[model samples]
Target: MRSMLKFAFRFIKNDGHRVTAKCKAEGCPWSIHASKGSATQLISIKTMNPTHTCRGAAVSSGPQATGSWAWRGKESAQEHLQGSHKDAYSQLPSLCDRIMETNPGSLATFTTKEDSSFHRLSISFHATLSGFVQGCRPLLFLDSIPLKSKYQGTLLTATAADGDDDRQNGLQEPICEIFKGSYHGYCLRCIAEQLVRDLKGQCSQEVKRIVIEDLHHADFAPNPEDFNASVERIKKN
Candidate 1:
């Protein structure tokens, strides 16, 4: 997983018992084979030709890794995995700068409280933004997830045209307090979901389905008369 993400190369063969991979170059002669024991699952390197005669290292017209660089990649993975959480927070500015430097047009922002404690951090990669723009989706899904780190925090994420969840259901109380005299509204889908949950243990599936269909039909009615008719069509069952 690390090598694939780091180097952007695909292995030719990899099964439970054996794995074989060659250098990206056609005739680089750099290849490796390893086999796993059936009982113990211990992997053993069977063959390795540790040499690269490739023309040049290339990655999307940028600098690339070759030869002894494998060790460097391993070291990088190790450092990233084992780095201190405190140090990461302390060095966030440098990390954000490096992110923008390496990936132009990326946005990275951080907030600090009055006493200088880290408050929030947000990052959106250039590639991700570009892809979202090209996809031309008009909708966004905003969600807040609680982090399970040593210091608890919320991780808020926004994605283009993602699926729905109970996230909006959490807004009812806050919206009431913030926007006085304004009633909170829910879409037919949310109403149907809440209705289904309320009826799950008590009502039959047919009753639940009929209620949801009536609720949806009420929303789709073209006129007040039709809407009233649809509403009247619904029953307590």
Candidate 2:
């Protein structure tokens, strides 16, 4: 007498790279069919913590705790930004320190009481993403500007995607290498030209698009001719 039966199958595991295994059986038709066992796939993923922090990061064991606690150290965000932490200006600011130290202290410093009227435009910029992604253009956007201790009629330029869309857009932190002389056409042009060069250098000759908003009507305005000239310079670059 001949007997027949139907069989079912299912996946046991998935490792990002490939599937693993087949049904375990003794002299079963499907068992022989599993002759070609699959190898497990390995995938790298960035895990986010409940608090929205990056996970699976390797931490320094020498006098440092694991995860962000090590990087965050003992300072609060405000304190870090205000240079309150011991490492705030640990190394790179040596040049800036020398320059400021040698300069006369006659620069006009603004006080919070009198400078409340001053406004600013926030700008965020981004660079190329992948190494294989060649010739990929970089972008910039504007956000709300913050007030600072000193001002030179500072005109802030940000990425356009951010400036145009109120929604959140991923962008690299703004590189402040583009603060042109504030309030004049010539100054703006100089700033723009330098910024274009900076973008080109930073993006590995990949930045081809520029986005800017004419926010002159809202608050502290820049010189119109200079603005136009600055745009022209960027285009020429």
Candidate 3:
């Protein structure tokens, strides 16, 4: 098993009759558990680590086992942060000040608890904001993904598309009141998807074709009059 996986493992602990083995690398979370089967002297694996996040440098001693530069950099950063988390919290104000001083027109903001511990941090670079305001489209897309670190958190991102369909970075917050107005438009892909789902096994191919084509025309119409006319035609069809 060690040869196949190409990593060293150490016996962690024995819980009841089950024996657990974990990777020898520090900060790695990979582990496996095994237990004796019904037949005497037969050992069966109850659980195994499907994916190993530790790099080859941390797991192997052989000269040929070189890890990627990106992975090594990330591991080094994580180790530094883990060791200096308290120092980082204390230097947050100075860091924010330096960022604003180095990059004029940039925005840096953070919140802290009563004890001066870090709560949240946000930054918007001057160049990124300027590019978005000058060249990108009005539409903004917002998303958040979970961060995979010792300090668990979510990374929020905002993006936009230019006229050429290229993605540009920006920022936006969810405002329920802003979306209540008639200025908002429905997503064409979403509308088509709903149509397919609602009309599945119920409407004939001819009717579906007419409804879908009319909806597309209404959505992409050059003027409000053409849009209303296409909507009326869809209703009649």
Candidate 4:
């Protein structure tokens, strides 16, 4: 199953002393059958149709009990496809050290479970921090984009607008602690999209335009008075 998934193939299985499996995708010409001589005997592939339009899998030799061909092939293929998540995580401390060594005056912190599983990580490079402080404005747009991996986590980002539009990961905690006076606000693009949805069916198209325009105006407003005035304009409209 892990090998099939790694190769992006869908499968249906029938499990027993003799087992059969096939790609579940319509018209996918991939199938396999395996049987065991005894409870402790080596499993042997009785038959296999490895030509799959859905995906390509490594074909193993039959009767792999000796780890020569059949069982060895499938086991090694599954293990390789399943990936080295544990091994990669074990090197995280070295990765963190490398990040700091390459970029001095940076922050890199991570938490681990008692058993040494990954908990969370935070990183902010010296260039990123200094650029935000010296060049960018005080408003910070925070967003958590989902990370697609075996161990899923959030790729939190803090973007400074009107700068280079370059972004860095791991700002969920650093923003609160380091950027002491920055406004941790929603991403303007996301807020505007949600605002458009909220305006639907509640107001005319003209009113929606007025509200959205006022939203941008309020966001760019230079003073409290100007911001309030922009908000008040929405009510008047």
Worst lDDT 10-window in candidate 2: 1-10
lDDT digits (tens) for residues 54-92 of candidate 1: 633342223353434544433333333444457779998
lDDT of 3 at 222: 100
lDDT of 3 by residue, 1-37 (tens): 4454467767776544556778787877767566656
lDDT of each: 0.67, 0.33, 0.67, 0.68
Task: Tell me each candidate's TM-score.
Answer: 0.34, 0.15, 0.37, 0.38
Q: lDDT: which is higher, 2 or 4?
A: 4
Tell me the RMSD of model 2 versus the true structure. 24.4
Candidate 2 pairs with clashing backbones? 17-41, 18-41, 122-143, 122-145, 140-159, 140-160, 141-159, 185-226
Which candidate number maximizes lDDT? 4
Global Cα lDDT for candidate 2: 0.33
Residue pairs in clash, model 4: 64-71
lDDT of 4 by residue, 82-126 (tens): 435577777778888999999999998878889877998888999
2 or 3, which is superior by TM-score? 3
Q: What is the C-alpha RMSD of each candidate to the true structure, in Å?
A: 17.5, 24.4, 17.7, 16.9
Best candidate, TM-score-wise?
4
Candidate 3 weakest lDDT stretch, 10 residues: 167-176
